[model samples]
Target: MTLALRLGKTLAELAGHQAPMTARELIFWMAFDQLSPISDRRSDVHAAQIATAVYQSQGAKVAFDDVLIDWSGEEEGVAEDDDALETLFAALSQS
Candidate 1:
Protein backbone atom coordinates (compact mmCIF):
# COMPACT_ATOMS: atom_id res chain seq x y z
CA MET A 1 0.00 0.00 0.00
CA THR A 2 0.96 3.59 -0.34
CA LEU A 3 2.25 5.37 2.74
CA ALA A 4 -0.98 7.31 2.87
CA LEU A 5 -3.14 4.21 2.67
CA ARG A 6 -1.11 2.38 5.25
CA LEU A 7 -1.22 5.34 7.58
CA GLY A 8 -4.94 5.71 7.04
CA LYS A 9 -5.47 2.06 7.93
CA THR A 10 -3.32 2.46 11.01
CA LEU A 11 -5.23 5.57 12.03
CA ALA A 12 -8.50 3.77 11.57
CA GLU A 13 -7.27 0.85 13.60
CA LEU A 14 -6.03 3.17 16.31
CA ALA A 15 -9.16 5.27 16.38
CA GLY A 16 -11.51 2.23 16.23
CA HIS A 17 -13.45 4.11 13.59
CA GLN A 18 -12.96 6.03 10.41
CA ALA A 19 -10.35 8.69 10.90
CA PRO A 20 -11.58 12.22 10.78
CA MET A 21 -8.37 13.34 9.10
CA THR A 22 -6.77 12.57 5.81
CA ALA A 23 -3.76 10.28 5.51
CA ARG A 24 -1.50 13.15 4.42
CA GLU A 25 -2.60 15.16 7.43
CA LEU A 26 -2.00 12.27 9.82
CA ILE A 27 1.41 11.65 8.26
CA PHE A 28 2.28 15.31 8.60
CA TRP A 29 1.45 15.14 12.28
CA MET A 30 3.45 11.95 12.73
CA ALA A 31 6.40 13.27 10.74
CA PHE A 32 6.31 16.45 12.78
CA ASP A 33 6.39 14.43 15.96
CA GLN A 34 8.57 11.49 15.04
CA LEU A 35 10.92 12.52 12.23
CA SER A 36 11.95 15.94 13.39
CA PRO A 37 14.76 16.20 15.93
CA ILE A 38 15.62 12.58 15.36
CA SER A 39 18.48 11.89 17.72
CA ASP A 40 19.34 8.36 16.64
CA ARG A 41 20.65 7.52 13.22
CA ARG A 42 19.68 3.87 13.63
CA SER A 43 16.07 4.70 14.27
CA ASP A 44 16.02 7.24 11.49
CA VAL A 45 17.39 4.70 9.06
CA HIS A 46 14.83 2.16 10.17
CA ALA A 47 12.03 4.61 9.62
CA ALA A 48 13.32 5.41 6.16
CA GLN A 49 13.43 1.73 5.36
CA ILE A 50 9.84 1.30 6.43
CA ALA A 51 8.83 4.34 4.41
CA THR A 52 10.55 2.92 1.36
CA ALA A 53 8.67 -0.36 1.74
CA VAL A 54 5.38 1.47 1.96
CA TYR A 55 6.14 3.58 -1.09
CA GLN A 56 7.32 0.61 -3.08
CA SER A 57 4.20 -1.32 -2.18
CA GLN A 58 2.23 1.23 -4.14
CA GLY A 59 4.79 1.50 -6.92
CA ALA A 60 5.76 4.98 -5.76
CA LYS A 61 9.28 6.31 -5.97
CA VAL A 62 11.34 6.29 -2.82
CA ALA A 63 12.93 9.64 -2.07
CA PHE A 64 14.06 9.54 1.52
CA ASP A 65 16.11 12.72 1.29
CA ASP A 66 13.28 14.74 -0.16
CA VAL A 67 10.83 13.33 2.36
CA LEU A 68 13.15 14.10 5.22
CA ILE A 69 13.62 17.65 3.98
CA ASP A 70 9.88 18.17 3.73
CA TRP A 71 9.30 16.62 7.12
CA SER A 72 11.93 18.84 8.69
CA GLY A 73 10.29 21.88 7.17
CA GLU A 74 6.89 20.75 8.45
CA GLU A 75 8.23 20.56 11.97
CA GLU A 76 8.76 24.31 12.15
CA GLY A 77 5.19 25.31 12.97
CA VAL A 78 3.85 21.96 14.10
CA ALA A 79 3.93 22.25 17.82
CA GLU A 80 2.95 19.25 19.93
CA ASP A 81 -0.57 19.90 21.06
CA ASP A 82 -0.91 17.87 24.19
CA ASP A 83 -4.69 17.64 24.12
CA ALA A 84 -4.86 16.37 20.58
CA LEU A 85 -1.96 14.02 21.06
CA GLU A 86 -3.45 12.76 24.26
CA THR A 87 -6.73 11.98 22.58
CA LEU A 88 -4.99 10.06 19.88
CA PHE A 89 -2.85 8.20 22.36
CA ALA A 90 -5.83 7.34 24.47
CA ALA A 91 -7.55 5.85 21.48
CA LEU A 92 -4.48 3.87 20.58
CA SER A 93 -4.00 2.62 24.10
CA GLN A 94 -7.52 1.29 24.20
CA SER A 95 -7.05 -0.64 21.00
Candidate 2:
Protein backbone atom coordinates (compact mmCIF):
# COMPACT_ATOMS: atom_id res chain seq x y z
CA MET A 1 0.00 0.00 0.00
CA THR A 2 1.01 3.59 -0.59
CA LEU A 3 2.42 5.67 2.24
CA ALA A 4 -0.74 7.72 2.52
CA LEU A 5 -2.90 4.61 2.73
CA ARG A 6 -0.67 3.09 5.33
CA LEU A 7 -0.65 6.28 7.34
CA GLY A 8 -4.40 6.57 7.08
CA LYS A 9 -4.78 3.06 8.43
CA THR A 10 -2.36 3.74 11.23
CA LEU A 11 -4.12 6.96 12.15
CA ALA A 12 -7.46 5.20 12.06
CA GLU A 13 -6.19 2.53 14.38
CA LEU A 14 -4.78 5.14 16.74
CA ALA A 15 -8.09 6.94 16.81
CA GLY A 16 -9.94 3.66 17.31
CA HIS A 17 -12.20 4.52 14.41
CA GLN A 18 -12.12 4.19 10.63
CA ALA A 19 -12.86 7.79 9.93
CA PRO A 20 -11.24 9.04 6.74
CA MET A 21 -8.12 11.12 7.13
CA THR A 22 -7.67 14.22 5.06
CA ALA A 23 -4.73 14.75 2.72
CA ARG A 24 -3.50 17.58 4.91
CA GLU A 25 -3.41 15.33 7.99
CA LEU A 26 -1.58 12.61 6.09
CA ILE A 27 0.95 15.03 4.71
CA PHE A 28 1.45 16.54 8.15
CA TRP A 29 2.14 13.12 9.65
CA MET A 30 4.51 12.17 6.84
CA ALA A 31 6.44 15.39 7.17
CA PHE A 32 6.55 15.07 10.95
CA ASP A 33 7.98 11.59 10.67
CA GLN A 34 10.61 12.62 8.19
CA LEU A 35 11.49 15.69 10.18
CA SER A 36 11.98 14.10 13.55
CA PRO A 37 14.06 15.58 16.38
CA ILE A 38 11.23 18.02 16.42
CA SER A 39 12.70 19.69 19.47
CA ASP A 40 15.47 20.91 17.20
CA ARG A 41 14.54 24.27 15.76
CA ARG A 42 15.79 23.33 12.30
CA SER A 43 13.71 20.16 12.05
CA ASP A 44 10.61 21.99 13.21
CA VAL A 45 11.20 24.60 10.52
CA HIS A 46 11.63 21.99 7.81
CA ALA A 47 8.47 20.17 8.83
CA ALA A 48 6.54 23.41 8.82
CA GLN A 49 7.85 24.19 5.35
CA ILE A 50 6.72 20.87 3.95
CA ALA A 51 3.36 21.07 5.67
CA THR A 52 2.79 24.61 4.40
CA ALA A 53 3.36 23.45 0.86
CA VAL A 54 0.96 20.56 1.24
CA TYR A 55 -1.78 22.70 2.76
CA GLN A 56 -1.33 25.53 0.28
CA SER A 57 -1.46 23.13 -2.64
CA GLN A 58 -4.91 22.18 -1.44
CA GLY A 59 -5.93 25.87 -1.22
CA ALA A 60 -5.95 25.73 2.56
CA LYS A 61 -4.76 28.70 4.61
CA VAL A 62 -2.68 27.32 7.45
CA ALA A 63 -0.18 29.39 9.33
CA PHE A 64 3.22 28.23 10.46
CA ASP A 65 2.23 29.10 14.02
CA ASP A 66 -0.71 26.76 13.72
CA VAL A 67 1.49 24.02 12.34
CA LEU A 68 3.86 24.42 15.27
CA ILE A 69 0.98 24.25 17.67
CA ASP A 70 -0.38 21.08 16.12
CA TRP A 71 2.99 19.39 15.88
CA SER A 72 4.39 20.39 19.25
CA GLY A 73 1.25 20.95 21.27
CA GLU A 74 2.42 24.50 21.78
CA GLU A 75 -0.09 27.05 22.85
CA GLU A 76 -1.99 28.92 20.20
CA GLY A 77 -0.96 32.50 19.32
CA VAL A 78 2.62 31.76 20.32
CA ALA A 79 5.16 33.63 18.26
CA GLU A 80 6.44 31.73 15.23
CA ASP A 81 9.94 31.75 13.85
CA ASP A 82 9.75 34.44 11.22
CA ASP A 83 12.85 33.27 9.37
CA ALA A 84 11.42 29.79 8.98
CA LEU A 85 8.10 31.04 7.69
CA GLU A 86 9.84 33.29 5.17
CA THR A 87 12.05 30.46 4.00
CA LEU A 88 9.06 28.21 3.57
CA PHE A 89 7.19 30.73 1.46
CA ALA A 90 10.29 31.44 -0.61
CA ALA A 91 10.86 27.77 -1.33
CA LEU A 92 7.24 27.23 -2.22
CA SER A 93 7.27 30.23 -4.59
CA GLN A 94 10.26 28.79 -6.37
CA SER A 95 8.55 25.47 -6.96
Candidate 3:
Protein backbone atom coordinates (compact mmCIF):
# COMPACT_ATOMS: atom_id res chain seq x y z
CA MET A 1 0.00 0.00 0.00
CA THR A 2 1.02 3.60 -0.44
CA LEU A 3 2.77 4.97 2.64
CA ALA A 4 0.23 7.65 3.45
CA LEU A 5 -2.67 5.30 3.01
CA ARG A 6 -1.01 2.69 5.18
CA LEU A 7 -0.22 5.26 7.85
CA GLY A 8 -3.82 6.44 7.77
CA LYS A 9 -5.05 2.91 8.26
CA THR A 10 -2.65 2.38 11.15
CA LEU A 11 -3.82 5.62 12.76
CA ALA A 12 -7.40 4.39 12.50
CA GLU A 13 -6.44 1.14 14.16
CA LEU A 14 -4.65 3.04 16.91
CA ALA A 15 -7.81 5.04 17.52
CA GLY A 16 -9.85 1.86 17.81
CA HIS A 17 -7.66 0.10 20.33
CA GLN A 18 -8.96 0.04 23.93
CA ALA A 19 -5.65 0.40 25.76
CA PRO A 20 -4.12 3.64 26.92
CA MET A 21 -0.97 4.20 24.85
CA THR A 22 2.27 5.14 26.52
CA ALA A 23 4.48 7.85 24.96
CA ARG A 24 6.95 5.33 23.61
CA GLU A 25 4.23 3.23 22.02
CA LEU A 26 2.61 6.26 20.48
CA ILE A 27 5.96 7.44 19.13
CA PHE A 28 6.75 4.04 17.71
CA TRP A 29 3.45 3.56 15.85
CA MET A 30 3.37 7.14 14.70
CA ALA A 31 6.92 8.12 13.82
CA PHE A 32 8.89 4.91 13.31
CA ASP A 33 6.41 2.54 11.77
CA GLN A 34 7.20 1.06 8.36
CA LEU A 35 4.55 3.39 7.00
CA SER A 36 6.04 6.72 7.90
CA PRO A 37 5.36 10.40 7.42
CA ILE A 38 6.33 12.29 4.30
CA SER A 39 9.61 14.16 4.52
CA ASP A 40 7.72 17.42 4.75
CA ARG A 41 5.69 16.32 7.76
CA ARG A 42 5.99 14.56 11.09
CA SER A 43 3.53 12.82 13.38
CA ASP A 44 2.04 15.01 16.08
CA VAL A 45 3.73 13.11 18.86
CA HIS A 46 3.33 15.69 21.61
CA ALA A 47 -0.31 16.31 20.88
CA ALA A 48 -1.01 12.60 20.71
CA GLN A 49 0.62 12.03 24.08
CA ILE A 50 -1.49 14.77 25.63
CA ALA A 51 -4.62 13.39 24.06
CA THR A 52 -3.88 9.90 25.34
CA ALA A 53 -3.40 11.22 28.85
CA VAL A 54 -6.75 12.98 28.58
CA TYR A 55 -8.56 9.90 27.35
CA GLN A 56 -7.00 7.81 30.09
CA SER A 57 -8.05 10.24 32.79
CA GLN A 58 -11.56 10.58 31.35
CA GLY A 59 -12.05 6.79 31.58
CA ALA A 60 -15.84 6.34 31.72
CA LYS A 61 -16.45 9.54 29.77
CA VAL A 62 -15.13 8.03 26.55
CA ALA A 63 -15.94 4.81 24.73
CA PHE A 64 -14.22 2.88 21.94
CA ASP A 65 -16.09 0.70 19.41
CA ASP A 66 -19.20 1.05 21.57
CA VAL A 67 -17.37 -0.69 24.42
CA LEU A 68 -16.22 1.04 27.57
CA ILE A 69 -12.63 0.03 28.21
CA ASP A 70 -11.31 0.62 31.69
CA TRP A 71 -7.81 -0.47 30.77
CA SER A 72 -5.73 0.69 33.70
CA GLY A 73 -2.17 0.44 32.42
CA GLU A 74 -0.31 0.92 35.67
CA GLU A 75 2.69 -1.30 34.93
CA GLU A 76 1.70 -2.39 31.46
CA GLY A 77 3.15 0.43 29.45
CA VAL A 78 5.50 -0.52 26.62
CA ALA A 79 8.97 -1.58 27.69
CA GLU A 80 11.96 0.78 27.61
CA ASP A 81 14.49 -1.36 25.73
CA ASP A 82 14.75 -3.04 22.35
CA ASP A 83 14.66 -6.58 23.72
CA ALA A 84 11.55 -5.89 25.78
CA LEU A 85 9.93 -4.21 22.83
CA GLU A 86 10.81 -7.20 20.71
CA THR A 87 9.11 -9.39 23.27
CA LEU A 88 6.07 -7.10 23.39
CA PHE A 89 5.71 -7.07 19.64
CA ALA A 90 6.10 -10.81 19.54
CA ALA A 91 3.31 -11.16 22.09
CA LEU A 92 1.14 -8.77 20.09
CA SER A 93 1.53 -10.87 16.98
CA GLN A 94 -0.14 -13.77 18.80
CA SER A 95 -3.14 -11.67 19.78
The model with the greatest TM-score is 1
Clashes of 1: 0
- Against the hidden true structure, what lDDT does model 2 obtain? 0.69
* Model 2 per-residue lDDT tens digits across residues 1-95: 23534454656656677677768777777687565533367666788888888998999998876575354556667677999999999999999
lDDT of each: 0.64, 0.69, 0.54
Report the C-alpha lDDT of model 1 over 56-85, residue by residue, as the tens digit: 799997777634434344565577789999
Single out the weakest 10-residue window by summed lDDT for candidate 1.
66-75
- TM-score per prediction, in order, is 0.35, 0.33, 0.24
Q: Which ten residues in a row have the lowest lDDT in candidate 2?
A: 1-10
CA RMSD (A), model 1: 20.7
lDDT winner? 2
Candidate 3 residues 1-88, lDDT tens each? 2452456554434567655556765676555644655433233444455566678688845433223222454445555689888999
Alpha-carbon error at 91 in model 2, in Å? 34
| Candidate 3 whole-model C-alpha lDDT, 0 to 1 | 0.54
Q: Candidate 2 at residue 56, lDDT? A: 86
lDDT of 3 at 34: 49
**What does the lDDT read for residue 4 in candidate 1?**
36
